[model samples]
Structures are given as structure tokens and as C-alpha cells.
Target: MSHYAVFGHPVSHSLSPRIHAEFGRQTGIALDYTAIEATPAGFAQALDAFAAAGGKGANVTLPLKEAAFALCSVTSERARRAGAVNTLTRNDGQWHGDNTDGIGLVRDLTARLGLDLRGRRTLLLGAGGSARGVAPALLDAGVSELVIANRTPERADALVDLLGEPGRAHSRYWNDLVNEGDFALIVNATSASRDGLQEFSLPFALAASRTLAVDLNYGEAAIPFLAWAQAAGCRDRVDGLGMLVEQAAAAFELWHGVRPDTAGVYATLRGKDASLVTAD
Candidate 1:
């Protein structure tokens, strides 16, 4: 069996192995996908160890996405554009990086969730790796406006500058939520929910009746924000489970030169109702 792994700091909670195992079973690819805990300081060493162990490909997550990008010998245009890498292919002793996060998020929102993103006013919370990986795609998906807010305003501003769409994308302080007006879509992309570091402290006014709140997190990490959206009266809140499945399929395709049926795997993960537990 070919070796594969996912690297991140708090990766013990990952369901990548389960998702990928299902993909391999569907596609007849013999592969082992595991998650490893790696901090920023030790990521390179950990990656070196994996590569030494005959690893063929891997997935990068969380704070490690940019770190993975930095370690890549080559990266796809989307990876370059996003300045992050979520998928990695081993090529003759080199790591080739690509980002499928953007496409994954877009596919989930438009294709699966039945959301027409054209001209939707959106608010993206956080400007971290997850935010970077999906921001460009959201803009390209025709969100009329994207206001990025982060605890660190400079990071948010830098991401906007990278996007190079001042007319459509702007950066704001998280403290300015009330004045920023309601959005048709709000995405929680921060690691806060995963870290369990602090209360979300989001405003109820940030939601409109038409608003769809999305948290780029699933399982325990997803509850806080999705619950907030529910309590804030937004009916169509979504967790990241679908995006996770979609993105995993993209990564598996890149690694194996074949695409597996994601619907079955996603359905399996999602259970009989095919609805997130967050749904009413």
C-alpha cells in the first residue's frame, strides 16, 4: 500500500483517514492516510521524516498550509495565488503543492447547498491559512463584496492586498462587526473554534434573514459558530463536513490520477438524513 498522511498541529481529531479509506475502496487504490501532529517549528522535520518513509502524497491543514507551501519545490497556480497548500504530491524526491480548498468550498456552496453566489454580500471571519485558501475562489465565484475581518487587522489587510480586488474585497477589524451591516453569507474560517481559545463574540445583527452562515469547521470544532448562527436566527447554517469531503476528493484525485464518487463517502460520513447535526 502507498503511504500518505495529513499534517497539522491539532490533527488528532482528523477524519481524513476514514474519508480517504472510503475513497480508496471506491477507486481500488491501496493507500494509507494518517494524521500527524506537527507544530510550525517542527513541520519541516516531520515532513522530511514522512518523505523518508516512502510517502507518496499528503494533505496539509490549519497553520501548516503556508508552512507546507514554503517547503514545496513547486506549487500549482491556485496554490501560488492562495499562498497556501492543502495537497502535496511527491515527485521524484520533490514536493509539489496544490490547493483544493477554494474549489472545494465553492463546489459545496454552489453545487451542494444550492446557493447562487453571484453578487452575494459576504463576510469572512479570519485571514489565516483556511481563509487564504478559499478567499480567491469565493471572489471568483461572484460574491459581489467580501469583507475580511481578523483579530490582527494587518493580516486581514495583507490578504485583501493579495486578492488585488479593492472594489470587491476589503478588510475590517473584528470589532467593527455591528457597523459593517448584514451579509447574505458569513463564513467562519478562523481557528478560534478549533482552538477553543475564546468566545466567538459575534453580533446577531451581522445576520440577515437571507443570510447563510458557514463555518469552515466540522465536528466539535464546528459547533460554537454554527450554534451561534442558529441562535442568531439564521436558518441555513452549514458546517464544513461537505467541504471536507469535497476537498478530500480533490486531493485524492491529484494524488491518484482518478476521482472517486464523493457522494457515497460523504453520505456515509453524514449518515442517513444527509443533514448536518446542526440542521433543525
Candidate 2:
């Protein structure tokens, strides 16, 4: 079987192995996919060992995305723009990196969540790797205005400047959310909850009755932000599960030369019934 894995510090919770197994079943491709725990300091060494062990490709998550990017021999434009790499493929004794996070999030938002990003006023919380990965895609999706907010004002400004869309993208201090006014879509891209940090106490007025709230963290980590959105009367809320599944499909395609259908796998994962998964 071809070998693959996902590398992250706290990756036991990842559904990637199961997701890719289903994809392999659908395509009749024998593959072994697993999770490998690796900290930033050990990432390069772990990756090199994986490549030596017949590993074809892998996914990088959390604090390791930027580290993965630095190790890549070459990268896609999106990866370069994000300054992070979430997907890696071994080729010609070197690694080729790509950032599938943005496209995955966009597909989940537009196709699964029925969101029309065109001309929408969107608020992106956080200016870290997660934010960087998706900001360009959000702009490409045609958000009329993208407001990035973070505790570190300089980081937020730096991300906006990197995006290179001065007229449409801007940054704000986290405490200034109230004066920034309400937004149609508010996405929590921070790792606060995932890192066990205190839940963000955002201004309620920043959301309106028609606002949609999103948290880029899944499972228990998503609850704090989703709960806040609920109390604020957000019309809809979403966790990162959809994006996770979509991004896995993208990576599967990149690795195996085909994109398995994601709907059934997503439903199965969401409903916790593996028997219901269908790759077709």
C-alpha cells in the first residue's frame, strides 16, 4: 500500500486517515494513511523519515504549516501567497507544497453553506497562518470589504499589506470591533479555543440578525465562538468540519490523481456512522 500521513502536534483527533481510507476504497487504490505527531522542532526530520519510508504525501496542520513551507523545494502560488503549506507531495527527491485550505474553505462556504461572498462585508478574526491561508481566497471570492482584526494590530496590518488589495482589505484592533460596525459574515480564524486559550469576548453589536458566523476550529474547540454567535443571534453558524473534509478531498486529488466525492464521507463523519459513507 502507498503510505501517507498528517503531521500535527495534537493530531489524534484528525479525521484525515479515515477520510483518505474511504477515498482509497472508492478509487481501489491501496493506501495506508495515518497521523504522525510532530512538533515544530522535529517536523523536518519526521518528514524526511516519512519520505524515506515510501510516504507519497502528507498534510501539515497548526504550528507546522509555515515550517512545512520552508522545507518545500517548490510551492504553488497560493502557498507562496499564504506563506504556509498544508499539503506536501514528494516528487523527484524533493517536496512540492501547496495550500489547499483556502480553496477548501471557499468550497465549503459557497457550495455547502450556500454563502454568496460577492459584495459581502466580511470580518476575519485573527491574522495568523489560518487567516493568511484564507484571506486571498476570500478576496478572490469577491468579498466587497475584508476587515481583519487581531490582538496584535501590526500583524493584522501586515496580513492586509501582504494581500495587496488596499481598497478592499483593511485591519482593525480587536478592541475596536464595536466602532467597526456589523458585518454580514464573521469568521473566527484564531487558534484561541484550539490552544486552550480563553474564549474571545467579542462585541455583540458586531453581529446583526442576518449575520453568519464561522469558526475555523471543529469539535469542542468550536463551541465557544459558536455559542457567542448563538447568543448574538447570528442567522447561521458553522464549524471547520466542512472545510476539513473538503480540504482532505483536495489533498486526495493532488496525491492520487482524482477527487473523491465528499458529500457522503462528510455526512458520515458528521453523523458518526461510518457505514453510511459513499465515495461515489
Candidate 3:
């Protein structure tokens, strides 16, 4: 059987295995997908073992995305642009890398949510890999302006410098966000969701009734941000579950040459059947 896996530190909580299983079932392809947790020091060795064991493709998350990028013999332009890789395919004894996060977020926002990003003012709440992965795609979607606010302003500025789209994208300190005015969309791309209800405060001034607030983490991780969005009277709130499914579908297609219907799987996950699949 063809083998696949997701590599991460705290990977036991990942939904990739079940998502891919549903995709395989839908596409009439049988594959083995598992979550493999490895320490930062062990990532390279663990990956080597998986490859030797016939792992054809893999999904990478968190700290491993950048490491995966470094290990790739070839990379897609999007991966280069994001400075990270989330999907890896074995090619002639080498690994080819691609980033599906941006495309996934775009498809979820545009196709699933029916949101028109053209000329929309967006506030991206991080300068980390997750934010970097999606920013270029949002710019490509015709966002009029993107203001990245990070606790460490320099890191955010560094990302703006990389993108080199000065006229449309800029970085701001977290404190200055309140004066930036209302945004059409606000994406929480930081690790804030993982920490739950933090002491951090969002600038409610940046949100209007028409603003769409998105937390790039699902389930309990999304509650704090979504709650703030609701209290601020934002038009809508969403979690990253849709992006997760879409990106997995994209990776599955890349590996197996078939895209699965995400709507059914998404529903199954949201309807509480997600925990039925064991990580091991």
C-alpha cells in the first residue's frame, strides 16, 4: 500500500489522517495515512525513515514546514514565496515541495464562503508561517490593502520586505492596529488560538458589522477569536477547518491525481464524527 503521513511535534491532534482516509474512500484509492510526531531534533531522521518505508507523500505542519522546505530538492514558486512547504511528494528518490495553505484559504473564502476579496482591506494578525502562506494569495485575489500587525513589529516588516508589494501591503505594531480603521476581513493567523483565551486584546475598532473575522485554528482553539468577533459585531466568523479540508484535498489530488468532495468530509468532521478516527 502507498503510505503517507503528517509530520509535526504535537501531531496526535491532527485531522489529516481521517481527512485523507475520507478522500481516499471518495476517490476509490486505498492509502495509509498517519500522524507522526517527532521532536525538532528528530524530524529529519523520522522523515528519512518514512521515505525508506515507502511514504510517497506527506503533509507537514507547524515547526516542520520550514524544515521540510529546507529538505526539499525542488519547490513550487508558492513555497518559495511563503518560505515554507506544507506538502511534499517523493520524486525519483527526491522530495518535491509545494505549499497548499494559500490556495486552500483562497478557495475556502471565495468558493465556500462566497466572499469577494477584490479590493477588500484585510488585517492579518501574524507574521508567522501561517500568515506568510496566505498573504500572497490574498494579494493575488485583489485585496486593496493588507496591514500585518505583530507583537514584534520587525518580523512583520520583514515579511512586507519579502513580498515587496509596498503599495498594498505594510506592517504595523499591534498597538497601532486600532487606528487602522475597520477592515473588511481580519485573519487570526498567530498561535493565539492554540493558547486559548489569552490576555491579548484585539482592536474592536478594526472590525465593523461587515467584517469577516477568521481564526486559522478550529474547534476549541477557535472559540476565543470567534467570541471576540461576535462581541464586536462582525458580520461573520469562521474557523480554519475549511482551509484544512481544502488543503488536504489539494495535496491528495497532487499525490493521487483525484480531488475528493470536501463538503461531505467537512460536514462529517463538523458533525462530531472527527474524533472517531484514532491518530495512531
lDDT of 2 by residue, 146-204 (tens): 99999999999999888888999999988888898889989988888866765668889
RMSD of each: 2.9, 3.3, 2.4
Model 1, global lDDT: 0.87
Alpha carbon RMSD to native, model 2: 3.3
lDDT of 1 by residue, 121-226 (tens): 9999989889999999999899999999999999999999988889999999888888987999999998786565545679899996789999898766678888
Ranking of predictions according to lDDT: 2, 1, 3
Cα miss at 275, model 3 (Å)?
7.7
The global C-alpha lDDT for each of the candidates, from Candidate 1 onward, is: 0.87, 0.87, 0.86
- Candidate 3 deviant stretches above 4 angstroms: 196-200, 273-280
Ranked by lDDT, the better of candidates 1 and 3 is 1
Q: Clashing residue pairs, candidate 2? A: none
Clashes of each: 0, 0, 0
